[model samples]
Target: MALILSQLFISLILSLFFSLTLLPHATTSKANSSSEYSITSIFNVTAANHKTSQILSFKPFHNQEEFPQTFSSSSSFKLKLYPAASLYNTHHQHKNYYSLDLNASLNPGITTGTSNFLVQIGVGGPPQKFYMIFDLQTDFTWLQCQPCIKCYDQPDSIFDPSQSSSYTLLSCETKHCNLLPNSSCSDDGYCRYNITYKDGTNTEGVLINETVSFESSGWVDRVSLGCSNKNQGPFVGSDGTFGLGRGSLSFPSRINASSMSYCLVESKDGYSSSTLEFNSPPCSGSVKAKLLQNPKAENLYYVGLKGIKVGGEKIDVPNSTFTIDPYGNGGMIVSSSSLITMLENDTYNVVRDAFVAKTQHLERLKAFLQFDTCYNLSSNNTVELPILEFEVNDGKSWLLPKESYLYAVDKNGTFCFAFAPSKGSFSILGTLQQYGTRVTFDLVNSFVYLHTLCCN
Candidate 1:
């Protein structure tokens, strides 16, 4: 009996030693009490999936000269998408503008310097590669061109239109020029476009038609895009923006894509990439929701968000809380660029109160950034958080996993509810809540499908 006990004790000690050694080292402080938790330690407590944990642990790129490219298949074009943080070292310096300010009277476009997913494409005849922000809110594919009058610094080399034999400047008389909002005719007869975003990021230059090549999916000829000679903003680390909105000039509309789908892995690991598919079917067992349209902003994707539930119990909010007004001032939009979900003030208050009530037993911490509801989980070994569910069109419940709605704010086991209050009447379902889910947009049928944890 003594010999058997000794062997078991030795095995247990070895296991514990290995586990302790494997734990990631983190820097913590009691004074400020706002330390970033190591990826391993946060995952250990939250039980988050490996993909999400990898995202939290991503390190900035060391090489600026090398650009990453996406690959595709033949039947349906599939471009690989990478989180902006993984490809650019400058993403950390920009302020987080995850929520849209619709009251400013500016239409939604690229939210200043904060772009989330990026796609790489080749422009011109010989196909010079450029990294562009994949945006779903606007529909003008634009990039900074050579001989720029004024341009912001980008990681890739400025695209020289003279180098590509297939590049042709669009004339002011062309139909494509008429599609632009504030288009004009240049002195040289070329079509000129001037677009100013809500955050003051503007791009002005001649519109052109060029051959854009995609890996494995061949090339698209005569695609209408902007060759900006004057562009300025905090557009760090990317060459330009590739609009995938519902406008006539959007990439999807230009390509005549029947349906589009994307699986956001949300990993900033340099090697990891997510797939953005054009003309693809939703995965098996997808929860379907009807797509809502707003006349004011027809290009943006709006969904019917009827109500919200916490721990399987519905919150008492009026039906008008998430409705779009007559002038299209209020609604819910699923945005790929926004970092965190934003709810209108009234609706947000109800949701926050529900979470606060459930977590009353836990220790409260100072509000972190935009998060007002936060907790300290340092002493607890295992914690059970309430599951959040969104009731969309057709009464379908879109369930959010614990990791999707709750995030570790520090290395000291401090966590915060991942939501913010919007300044306007509208609410935005941002990318953080879409992680590990496959969101499919079926334009033909006007439906959106959600496949939870499909990427994992």
Candidate 2:
């Protein structure tokens, strides 16, 4: 049972997930072919003539102090999102994926916190590598195969499938075994699935279709995945959970990528290292937004905010508070495993009363869990504070500094407003409001850009 990023738990929202090692899909040739889009992997880098994207270099999950940082006494701090945060603990129920965030707070109590995004792929027909948990909200990609009965603990070894040679399984009349998500039809015909991971964890698995090479590029073949064999949750060091949703089996609609970029870099105690670019993005265009498409939370990525700013004023809010209803509930999302930012509660009390009327002599404190506003600052005060925008609806706005809405709680030395409110009306910008920034994600041209980092 794996697939997560309930990195948003904060009692407000932080969701994160993992619990994998999926693999089982085999058919070879064509991944939306035209010659597998002109072969190339390991991030080969190319743009003008296209067909050369296969960039890779993002691997940081060396435990990082285990995550899940929640406290209360020293004055207050909490990051619980599960039944009390969980990113590991599997050696009987099986858990060696101390990777992605179960609570994603390396230690937000102050310094080293929030991190999730590991990469390294290659599966079958002789390829092996693994690592996973890239998740743009998952679509279908799995691993943890081998002659097992109940697997787990996969840092390496376990993908065997008779040493690749283009492994296979799909059976039940292909079409990627009916796009598993609660599928069925086994008895030995294969295609069986079960899924279920918004944190309640679940997995039955069978759906196969291997051969997805990538050290940087080329080796498409067969693709479709999810060969769990057995799984639980937490997925520590990782072994599966890749998908970069939009459906059609994800991975940006099977490598069609008209766009893709990532850069969160800010490291130095969180020890950072990031990269996830495809199809040119060291910089480009610089402004764009309009991704909203929540088929009832299908992989998550909505937008259309339109309200926010402090320095220049403009806390008008209510454009339906960002609109999205039709039952999918008011929009807002950009969570790479959410770290903070959650608005929506009367638009966060009218943007926290317009930032407490511009810091009225700073002092407030008391609502711990979803942070009402929190405050402390004083030491050599100069305090100009103000300049915090978010307005997105063309007239453009995404700025927000002051360490992205504050947050220092040096064990109660105080300083937080890392932003939080939503009990659940949908709103989650997280990733600490996307630190250094630089997020592309064009999803074949439906929009999504957000700048700042140039590829750090």
Candidate 3:
């Protein structure tokens, strides 16, 4: 009888194992009575043209407290922008772009680098939090998703779409799918997207419409974005990127925002936060400049840069050096990702020479990184820096603060000018130059408003 009992127990264990294998596999619990969607691996698709095989149903968030109602017309929200270095303990306090070995491949009027600012937002139905790079150069926002075949290591858990109740795949026939560059329809009729940055970083995945929630403004439904299953890059410490570009797939365009404003605080502590306001009115006493559009690259934010001034003396560079050609070759772009101001080679030479001439009394140091202008002022505490200004739109002088143009390399008073020459003819006015200022982009009026030293 004892031998028969042992045999019976073994038989029961085999039966249980088989039952568990036959049961449906799910990453998370079902939201409601609806059927749970199984996570589909990208490798399961046999067709050569097919990218992804997953299909998801749309269901509202069960927790109402996590996702509030849709935003009203006049309602506005603020997102805190933190320095990218704040997320990691080992990140260097000062990031000099010249030290980086960026990719040599070039794209038209586009350059990529390690983003300077990061913003946190919620994705999916239950509002899974994600830290993303807040970049103005990216046209489409994307994040790493589960079932990732190739993905970089991130601090947070990978976004699992199968677990989200509000995840919906976009069809190939939708107009939004057409907005993606080099997008194609999978064999299952789902829209697939692939984006490659100039820095050799790329992501490939299916287009999705998911719920995105902001901390102060509640949540927006069916926001179009990329759920990347295959991704590779050095994305700093962020999970993905939030694109604020003018493209149709950008966050501002997806939400139909008429205006947006961000104030970058001048702080090296990395933990200090700044504010990014959407649909906000221009700040009082702000100077307005006519925003220019590059027909070839409409997603970029271009402003008329008439000239540059050092110590109140305008540099003697041809005005055409800053003008955009008909083919959209040369133009000035206000970039939030770039840490240092970059100008065309000839234009930069003139500006650098003018700065050197004005600071002749200060002792000069060897060129540090890409910066040709470095000064050793170890003994001086109150040395006056040359006032730097940019002439924009009909001769409006936008004065730059001292911290914008000067960077202290070390504690011993080795300072370097915070400017560089662009790889191409196009110039970029980076965040370093815009610090301690409020930058407002009025899309409806096609204007950019600048308020100096207004960030508190």
Most accurate candidate by lDDT:
1
Task: Report every candidate's CA lDDT.
Answer: 0.68, 0.54, 0.67
Query: In model 3, what lDDT does residue 141 have?
Result: 85
All predictions: root-mean-square deviation over Cα? Answer: 11.9, 22.3, 20.9
What is the alpha-carbon lDDT for the whole of candidate 1? 0.68
Query: Which scores higher on TM-score, 1 or 2?
Result: 1
lDDT of 3 by residue, 11-124 (tens): 222111111001223432421111223322111112211111110111111111233434432367677776554454333342211222221212443544445667778898
In candidate 3, how many Å is residue 206 off? 1.0
Deviation from native of the Cα of residue 11 in model 2, angstroms: 16
After TM-score superposition, the amount by which residue 231's alpha carbon in candidate 1 deviates from its true location, in angstroms, is: 0.9
lDDT of 3: 0.67
Clashes of each: 1, 54, 0
lDDT of each residue in 56-100, candidate 2, tens digit only: 121223332321122112111111111112223333344333233
lDDT of 1 by residue, 145-262 (tens): 9888998777677999999989999999999999997999999999999988777778899999998776556667789999998987767667888888888989888888888888
Residue pairs whose backbone atoms clash in candidate 1: 37-411
lDDT of model 1 at position 221: 79
Q: Tell me the TM-score of model 3.
A: 0.79
- The TM-scores, one per candidate, come to 0.81, 0.32, 0.79
Clashing residue pairs, backbone N/CA/C < 3 A, model 3: none
